[model samples]
Target: MGKALIEKGQIYRNEEAWELFSNLITEITPSKVFVIADENTNKHCLPYFLKKINFEKSPEIITIPAGEIEKNISTCLKVWEILSDKGADRTSLIINLGGGVVTDLGGFVASTFKRGLRFINVPTSLLAMVDASVGGKNGVDLGHIKNQIGVINLPEMVILDTAFLETLPSEHITSGLAEMLKHGIIQSEAYWKRIKNINRENKVELNTLIWDSIEIKKAIVAKDPFEKNLRKTLNYGHTLGHAIESYFLENPNKKTLLHGESVAAGIILATYISKDLYGFPENKLQDISESMFKHFPKQTFSKKDIEAIINLLIFDKKNRNGKVLFVLLEDIGRHKTDCVVSNKLIFRAFEYYKNF
Candidate 1:
């Protein structure tokens, strides 16, 4: 039996995952089924997925362009049109088989189309497996901003298969590690230590860490499903991270960064801020910065670039009463939410990042 992550959804893993998924299809007996994948997963993951389960009828394949840039209202409109034309109703089921972009956009489309269609998230990337797919927070970017238009609707189930990670690039694997690292920083020091020493070549260890990361997220979401308090801690690195990601994404001159790469940078900056404001201990701060830099190469930002990134912070979803709020740390596993930081201090943090 699959373990329930929330009241509405359960997580199925590895050998048991396929058997449970097959059972689910029989139980739902949806009017029609749709499989949504980006170009990459369509080529790499869909074939394996199709072979594992037998659908009553052939699933309609909806392929979207791959990459973060393709996650938007325009893409959502295209998916919605496809769903409408293909006769997807409330009784239909959608299997989102890809990374965060596909899972997020597909979930949103399923939630909105015909006032909600049953959906399952088959997260193929490391980023999706541990974070995006597990959370039930689904949405797409608005312009250059991250996750601006979205919903907090749970999927019917989440199928996590580590086999799909073999299809990802090493950099992408590193990208996923950032969130796992964040899980450690905000939740457990032992987890942080274990994650910091991860040897990617060790498959058994890697899979165990992945499950552990999911449990950490599950515990947090269970307590604060609406992000009223404890759940806000999950955004520790994302506040500044999203801004940095948006800036690079919108700038033609700079190389666009993977979501985790930017978050790694955000974690470092936030740690510096935490140390300065709440006495979060400089030694741990140094440790975090060093570990992050080890996995993610430093991204250079000119003064003008930094300014634009700072400007994008105003659009962050965590803002309250027109004020930008952040989730900062007092120590490992100790966090404070909705804190304010001055521009001068932010600038100083950037200087620290640049110099380090």
Candidate 2:
């Protein structure tokens, strides 16, 4: 309860989220309440959500197949159909109860359904709670490309409950930490040092850390909602990171990397590039690299794998004028955006990551 209601959205921690949500929803009193979920949260999270809220009418529940592969136009059409069949209208309130995929796709459907329905986001996973839920960004992937099709729209309110994290997988927790680290890398050196102390002080509850991470992101998005300039700092690792994420997702032979896992690797490569291009301190790079490697095991990538990943960078959402624009760090807490990089440098960075 340190800082609730960031800008427009409401962020509650732990059990208090339920009462706040119940009160807020009861006040709005929508014509209908529709809850959306993926397979995982449907079975795991829905019961808790239903048990907490005292509704005038039981909300209709819609479940979709989970995972990134299910994020597409086809899946969206299915959600759209359910809303249409259920007579969801502008007065309807859609509650998205799940991780990034569920919240992302759910927001897209609700925003477009009848020219927008008021919706609430309840992010279950750490990724969603810290990064995905705070931002107004919502979209499904176009083919294997990540977030290529999405509109910018804030939810009526966002519900944050760490209780939902009890059922979350450990790997998903690690995945979200990558985003948390990015916040420090781009915003505050003091924040980065605190997170790096994870090795020494491992006893801290993730909920506290998560609150700080959300605050970091909220500070930036509050200034540049459209990602015009200041907000691009949020993409510190996402340019090549998205390319790596998309590459692994499309290749059957390669093990699929979680968004944050690929992002962890991308941050390493980008930091190396930053050192070469912007004089970022080598000691800082080493500490960041070691911390990331401690949590994420290195994936041995082939020469072809590197090339394929590099090629995918051209399709990055942050690209401009057919050039791959990078968000490089001049130092911790200092970022340089719109920087262009060459294939040769990317290859060298892969070599650095390999030997790192």
Candidate 3:
């Protein structure tokens, strides 16, 4: 069993993860257990999850539609109603079992229902395991704005079993790789070097890398749980990435992007901006661009799309006053937080991403 400790939660990995989860269930011994999953997880992951542990009472399973589109207050209202109707009290435990969407929305639901309820996260996707589920930042998007309504509430524990990845689509796996790469770029040059040659076929290596990413994030969050300073570095690529995600989500013409896909593009754009402003090495920029493009297919953006994405920047959580703040890097492992970036630079960054 692999374990990592966060401020208010514990993370367990692999076979030992199940052992820890069973122990946690025995300890909590809540009045009831509620498992919240998206449709895909309900169909694919729930059975395996049920088989692994014995529950004194059969847990109630709540299934939401599987997608980012379903992560909103309307869904939360329905879920809250279900919890209330099912006679859930503060003693009930919520087990969020799925990817980022499920965990994010489920955590929000659990946190808001009757003030608060104990919850555990069982992150099934790479994105959720390394980033979303670990951080305790749970919330749903407001309309097209991403993660606009949420709270930072730690779960009792987080269970990560790579076995769930087998049920994910290839694109989703690639999507999660984006966050792991961000971890390397923002915190560890050594990790960056190791991740540059990632081989998904080698399960052992991939799992090890995933754990390293989680540790990097865990260390950062421990230092700055509230994103007062150091934790802001974790938003390195997300500022613009989220805007692009929201724009695509609202637009009818473009195919919606996965969270990691948009972040992959945002990372490349931020690298370019960093090079322009901070004298980040040109050679390293080239290498980074090549690496990102190799994993994520280049996304074509029109002038209109770029403008719309930029306009959405006002909704970024990191914004201060009216200025847009970005997390820029002088080099891998050297990051600048809350730095103001101009529209002209942003346009240039998009151009750089488009032509790269």
Candidate 3 lDDT over 130-238, as tens digits, reads 9997778999999989999999999988888999999999999999999999998887678888998999999999999999999999999988999999999999889
Candidate 3: clashing pairs of residues: none
Q: Identify the runs in model 1 with alpha carbons over 4 angstroms from their true place.
A: 1-7
Report how far residue 142 has shifted in candidate 2, in Å: 0.6
Please report the TM-score between candidate 2 and the true structure. 0.95
Worst 10 residues of 1 by lDDT: 1-10
**Residues 162-279, model 1: lDDT tens digits:** 9999999999999999999999999878999999999989999999999999999999998898889999998988989999999999889889999999999999999999999999
Ranking by TM-score: 1, 3, 2
TM-score of each: 0.98, 0.95, 0.97
Determine the backbone clash count of candidate 1: 0
CA-lDDT, candidates in order: 0.91, 0.87, 0.91
